[model samples]
Target: MDRLSTRFKGTKTYLTNAALEASVNCALVLEKPLLVRGEPGTGKTLLAEAIAEALDMELITWHIKSTSRAQDGLYVYDTVQRLYDSRFGEGNVHDIRNYIRLGPLGGAFTADKRKVLLIDEIDKADIEFPNDLLHELDRMQFKIIETNEEIKAKYRPVVIITSNAEKELGDAFLRRCVFHFIDFPDRELMERIVKVHHPDIDERLVNQAIETFYQIRAMQRMRKPPSTSELVDWIAVLKSAGVTNTQLDQNLPFLGTLLKKEQDLVTYADQLAGGRRWRS
Candidate 1:
């Protein structure tokens, strides 16, 4: 545990826990991708950046979208470019490799040194997307049919994949990964995280703000609950305004920083008007 801690501790802005540490180390040892699922504001995407910083490896990110195809991650043969080159009598139109471009995964595989590959928001793509890359991920090799060239990983990259659970991933795809769920942190953990971000914050203000924050989260009618990042920003605003614990007790200033949605803000206002208090 201590050995793994030394290798992949979180960065100055990032905070990690025991479960995340174990899962990351397990993935590193087994050479499997770490599949992380959490809410949007959680540090799911940041985990890859932290790992790359800790391990001193280059970070390669593939931002998946609704129209993203798994094949695009491996290689793209630009037929349009080739046809244009041929028509215009440009150099090396006969060489198909000239138009071949390596994508993030392909670049990671061909790199001389190992890299940290982050496939962000896999669930944003089509349902078949995860299954499409199964063979290449499993074998760590891909073939470019146009150039009759096969590329293999010089060193297997440390892969980290994140999902917001917007869509269900395939069972076969799940079987190949080391899965970990990052639950929202509890009060103690939240305090530690807040301290990491804002070390000089007054203790009393931190306590009162966290208490109020949790109280807001506990509200049943909230459409979108404030997240960790929101709380951090809220505290920063309070500190800058020289808000005291007593002032926080009376009312939350800069409420926009914490509650983003109109419906949520309206709900909070209604609750406050109904004599709902900030503290239990």
Candidate 2:
């Protein structure tokens, strides 16, 4: 954890040994599911993305939705491909069954090699979805019930599941996973993250933005203040356009590039008018 650095040169993520050890254990040793719980925009999903990117592995992400069903985990057979095959070929039952395609999970398991499985925002998914995935997690295999044929994984990729802690998961489901909570980084760590993401951005701007975000954060009204990634977005966009604090007045329209909500933008504009140097 102490030695873990950002996988990408421009990445702001720096995980401690605790986080790294947990991930490595889940991926290589424990061979168990990892459940990451955190507040919104705390880089829970980014953890999985960074590991997959760092390892040069395939990233198979399932963005869990409220209606996501358990069966949707496997490969989605291209109906068009199946139909074409049926028309052109002898359409034997077994051949037709073989023609059906694999879903994301199925592909992850039975593909030519291993890949990272990011079940993102699992809290949005139905309870049955997690329960259904238990078997696959335990067995490292999935059966396409449509074909009544089993497909096993060549290698079980890192199974990283992220949740916003919106609801409580079943104890049985919790029993299958190694759980951890991701907290917001402190000011010093936040500055390190800023420099890591936007090397060319002036250090002053990074420092100012961090302080302003802290101001916004101090307000209890906002849903969530700017996070490290959002800070990256603001700095990256500003630098890419060659815009700086000196020219913010001329670039008012580009304010959209940084602040997201209209209220935040309004507040920033007011801050600028009060001679507070919002951009700087």
Model 1 lDDT tens row, 86-172: 999987998888999999999999999889999999999999999999988888999999988999998888999999999999999
Q: What's the distance in Å from true for residue 121, model 2?
A: 2.2
lDDT of 2 by residue, 1-280 (tens): 3123323231335444456555555544566778888766667887788767766778999889998876778755556776776688745534546666666777789767668889988888876678888888888887766667888888776788898877678888889888877767778877877776666668776776667566655544343466667666766776677654633442443445445787676665565565444445
Show where candidate 1 strays beyond 4 Å.
1-7, 245-251, 273-280
Which residue pairs in candidate 2 have backbone atoms (N, alpha carbon, C) closer than 3 angstroms, thus clashing?
Answer: 1-16, 1-17, 2-17, 74-103, 75-102, 75-103, 76-103
Candidate 2 residue 155 C-alpha distance from true site, Å:
1.4
**lDDT value, candidate 2, whole model:** 0.69
- Model 2 lowest lDDT segment of ten: 2-11
Q: Each candidate: what lDDT?
A: 0.88, 0.69
lDDT of 1 at 247: 40
RMSD of each: 3.6, 6.1
TM per candidate: 0.91, 0.73
